[model samples]
Target chain A: MDKYILGKYVPLNTFIHRLDPRMKILSMILLMVAIFMPFPSWTFTFVMSGFNALIIFVLMLISKVRLRDIIIQLRSIWFLLLVLMIINIFLPPNGSIHIIAQSGNFKLYAESFMQTGKVMLRLIEMFGVAMILTATTSPQELTFGFGWFIKPLKKIKFPVEEVSMTVSIALRFIPTLIEETNRIYKAQSSRGVDFKHGNLKMKFKGLIALIIPLFVSAFTMSDDLAFALEARGYNPKAERTSYRVLKWSTKDTIWIILITLFAAGIITISAMHLDLLRHFFPKIW
Target chain B: MQIEFKNLYFNYNNNSEFKVTVLKNINYLINKNNITAIVGKTGSGKSTLTELINYFLKPTSGQVITDGFISENSTKLKFKVVNKLRKKIGYLFQFSENQLFEDTVIKDVSFGVKNFYPKDDGYEQKSKEALRLVGLDESFDSRSPFDLSGGEKKRVAIAGVIAYKPDLLILDEPTAGLDAQGKKEIMDLFKKIHETGVQIILITHDMNVVLEYADEMIVLDNGSIQKYGSPKEILKENVEKYNLETPHIYKTINALKEKGIVLNNVTDIPSLVTELKKHG
Candidate 1:
């Protein structure tokens, strides 16, 4: 199994890894908001691109993780990229006069192509930022961040700690579960169950043989885990002291300020519709 | 019934880069109604040997020929044949927790029986009888299997298999991670079950259990049979040869042997105790 594809966060003492998960999560949300807020003639796009490049460079240098490794993680979604491109080329645009090309009965419009490029770039940027956050943060840190983020919901008696623990365990076991699924799949295949050779219906039914054993193993593991947890007297409601404190230092503050400013700059540029920037920039459309 | 493995070889993941050869060119026989103990160092193909007998794994080469069915020669094992074999051959997993999947203890025990005999009116009755045989009360039938203690869970797992009335019972490390009392209870339960004419095969690392209960023992090393003989003969002669420890009672016998205190019929604790009293 490709470890990176399953979000198995490689531990390293990199700058991105050092930043608090709460800050990383907040930055991810701000970046997504900036992407969707619209840009003025792709100038904001260049600014965001430079920002993403800076983060990626710092992460790669600090974490000592290869750039090729991150690319491998992104490769799983190559089909999604192709689908987005196809949808963009065929989608009808409102008030579009220019036809880029015609194939068979389909007319490719200019505006739709431009929109598709913007959407694809946005998708890449969003997921790229998300990958950085998840790959750098440990499951414990993420769970703690969840608890801190959802502190306001405590007034409603929401089981925030319990939910965070559940999320953490689920994230921790995803790789294990995937490995188990692969084992079971291989076992069934050895039994002369040709999963790949069958028609759609046959393939679907063949999946049953795999699913039943996987589910059986999962339920059994859950039972053992529950027993282990109970034996340790794990109380979700107990007040606990954390080993790692999430504190905001000068470097952390600077990182947050820079990210916030870049987000604000994108929004401001988009809202103002600055014509000088538009004229100077290349037409990404 | 006899199961003979002739030059059987098995690898868990045969095609992958990380393939592990668990059992290698193994040849052995499990005779009918005999209590055979399979002993080996960790990962010495003990569990794999038992799994091969029930066709849980297909041998890479050679054949495993049981009385009525021949697994190695068969092209594919049908569900009917597998289910039929399973009904007569019960396998108790090392971690008994994996064996209990139903809501309550009784339901978990009855799962195998219900699956094998869905329409039988005596299914529940048989489940209760199996539980009682394992020294579990009828009231435990409604208790959640998850809520039971480790020893209780093991008993329930045993009851689950016994409810199917299997002729051959194979246990994988049945006394693992249990207290002395828990271990004694489990060994006693095995004795009771064996007395009912079920052939028993125990895979274990504990030498004490082998001395106490097993009639025949086989030592496995690196996927091959190191030695196979009766417990007393294996312990008295070849245990140290395989770099295996003899049981404490046998160790005492060895100490007495150095002092020229020869005693006959000193295999078990009771006989040893009687011999010591005579010497005094």
Candidate 2:
């Protein structure tokens, strides 16, 4: 289940893999809105994970990638951020920077392990800038960068090219539904359906016998990919004209002026609540 | 039963950097209660050599032995020894009538006889005697294998892999997209489940269903094994230089052995119409 390395791509050509897929989808939606516009500020999460670790080390050295393939795509969502930081570091809250413990009636806090280690470092910097904008954009340049961000909302007529062809066929079927759920979980685990040592009611009946043949082979491959996108003449209100235009150079205006001066230096250092960068990232709170 | 495949090299991303090599440097030796077949054409590697006998793809390097169970790679076979060697290998799969998800045809032929005989006790009379051995009896058990048809959903997916009895079945293109009477009624219910001795293998491009039910053929192209033998000595030579295509009753018995008229064991079309009625 090599979990389709999340939105795959990886063809590597460098320089954030030649940017401007609408400036890497508007610098990954302004770096996931400046990593969830800070609120719990432990010196605003160590200066926003040290400016997202220098933008994940210059987008993994300009998309040559490999920091163990972005820690194997952020270790597939680290088991829901390690069960939400182990239920917020063993159930916190009644604070005063706690942990002056008494033994039996626990207490711990330290502001819930510095607020779940600053929400797991803002979820590993929003899953490493969405896996470096899907390993440097290519699914038809991320469907022409979400059809150039919904082409000016098609002048209010909307249906913006059928919502960018249903978001590029749901991001090209997330690696064809992870290779048809890894071939219907290797054809129902070659019909024995053990699915990794059962028992949770036989692993929920081997996950509904591998999700009813992965929803009957994903509704029989989306009805043969909707009759092969209606036998090719796919007219989502026609007039579609793109071969691969997107140019806007000057290195996409210096990546929109360094993501608008790093979102105005993270909203002016979270509105000046910088007690000297809280005496240098005072263990994140 | 005997499967072997020693220096077998199958590679599909052997730790990436675009690996691919799908079964090159391979070798053979199938021998165990007959049948074989395996022709080629569509990206050769005949369904990656029937998923390396039943590891469902492993050999990115070597070994696969089988009926003495060796394995060697594909993570040295575990998961209860590949579900007890997939309950003795019943494979099927290439449009195995879309691996039916069950909802009937007697719970999809007792879903692999209750996943490899879970405490037996006549698993509903062995899933209605494997749906009456693929002809589909017991009034099509409680219908709805998506309401049958395309050759009764490939005989309820070959009675759900021979109702888990498998002594080695490996099918693949079991009469793909049928219709010459659904490919002679699923090759006469796989020649009555290979006369109950089981050991089948099949995988075809249909050199007339490997000259009417192969007793060993192989062929494969790019990823190696160009000819392994005995479909009347690999369809009697110049089989279009191994791209294949001889079976039109082996080009009318090689145009009546180029007029000299020798028909020694004519392979099919009713054994070349009973050897041209002994030369009329």
Q: What TM-score would chain A of each candidate receive against the reference chain A?
A: 0.82, 0.37
Candidate DockQ scores, in order: 0.07, 0.17
Steric clash pairs (candidate 2): none
Q: Please report, in order, the local distance difference test score of every candidate based on alpha carbons.
A: 0.75, 0.77
TM-score against truth, every candidate: 0.58, 0.36
In model 1 chain A, the worst 10-residue window by lDDT is A185-194
lDDT of 2 by residue, A124-222 (tens): 666677778888888878888778877898888888778777877877777777677676677667878787786777667778777776788778788
Residues A1-285, candidate 1: write the lDDT tens digits.
Answer: 554433556666677888887888888788777767754444455565556556655645665545565567558777877787677676765656578888899888876766666666666656566667777888878888877899799889988777877998887788788877765554333222446664786567457756765787788788999999999998888977777778767887888899899888767867876644546664842
RMSD of every prediction? 8.1, 21.1
Name the top lDDT candidate. 2
In model 1, what lDDT does residue B173 have? 89
